[model samples]
Target: MIETNVLTITQLEHRYGGVTVLAVPFFELARGRHALLLGPSGCGKSTLLHLLGAILTAQAGRIEIDGVDLAALAPRAADDWRGRHVGLLPQQLALVSSLCVRDNVLLPAYAAGLPADEQRAQALLAGLGLADKAHAMPHQLSGGQRQRVAIARAMYTQPRLLLADEPTANLDDRACATVVALLARQARDANASLLIASHDARLVAALPGAAVLRLPARGELPCAA
Candidate 1:
């Protein structure tokens, strides 16, 4: 049997404004595997996630997601490919202020220029216990509800690689477990590889069969922030 990696980073070195902030020797996540990135707030966990998501370009490194080298693609090409192949839930969620929950979840499909599947979007919302809030705005929902909306949005496209940045942050113990389970289940159902960057220990314990990547806390925030 041949093994294929869904996410790979080699000699990754990222700098911001003339300072070296993140340097990762090597990392790999195979398809359908769940991996947790553990680190302190300023340890470049988020930086690594952004790099994998194609939000930021690494100064010196190789990043291959689902076999495509991210550094070689043009910006628009990268963006389009990411839209089609990667499901990203950043720390901020980045939900549109004006769009309702339904539309927000559908944003990825829309951006990918794919036909809208309202049924799929609603189904995901229902699974996340946000069916009633499908019409609600971001501000109207609680933090956990909003987090679920983000999860739905990320899963809407059924991506091959799911990158989550601190998805369990700010939630209580129960909420944290719920979100982690949802993410794990959704990734399994989709056969997508899940790579989460978080400082939450409970999250680390909750993920079964998940490989871990740990980063050290370096006191100051990265310049890329």
Candidate 2:
């Protein structure tokens, strides 16, 4: 998960319920560049994101990121790799309800066995306009604030690759634009590649220079990994 370069994938495929769900012939994203995984609801956009992030296994394929073969990694190794090298803003925005905003942002650092920096976490929140909410619990934050917290958490370790799933689906038009711009700017400043999997067409227009990785037709069946 940690290294130079962005991503490399070839002949990727996944299946569920005895049916093929995703297939990708080949794809790659360079470091500091942006990529969008565009597909319909059932086209396995989420599944492909999971596969690329080492959160799910594919039936057959090869995915190499930062010179590490994620598909070949052991489960613990995969988790370690993700913890150290990958930053993910999952579809669920999985924040701990009991943790304060600052603690939530530091979770990734703690998970990676690195020292959590209070000043850095505060800076991240302040930059994102959440400086005053640092001590607030997740339940007390608005949906948009929670999403920003998730983004801050994903960035605590300064990951090499940042992955997001349906990031703008729940926001209003104004908020959507704001979130997209924030994500692209932060990733660029951090020197991390940003990959967003979303069906929203607005994203393509919003991220002008982003490479698009549209998933293949959902008819590719292969044996499970």
lDDT scores of the candidates, listed in order:
0.86, 0.86
| lDDT, residue 167, candidate 1 | 90
Provide the TM-score for each candidate, comma-separated: 0.91, 0.90
Clash count list over all predictions: 0, 0
Model 1 pairs in collision: none
Candidate 2 — which residues are off by over 4 angstroms? 1-5, 216-225
lDDT of 1 by residue, 50-147 (tens): 88888889999899887789999899998988887789998998999899999999998788788999999999999889889989999999888888
**What TM-score does candidate 1 get on C-alpha atoms?**
0.91
| C-alpha RMSD values across all candidates | 2.6, 3.3
Q: Which stretches of candidate 1 lie over 4 Å from their true place?
A: 219-225
* Candidate 1 global lDDT: 0.86
lDDT of 2 by residue, 1-225 (tens): 754557889888777876678878889877667999997787889898889888998888899998888878999999888887888999899999989999999998777678889999999999889999999999999999999999999888788888999999967888888889999987887888889999888999889889998764454334322
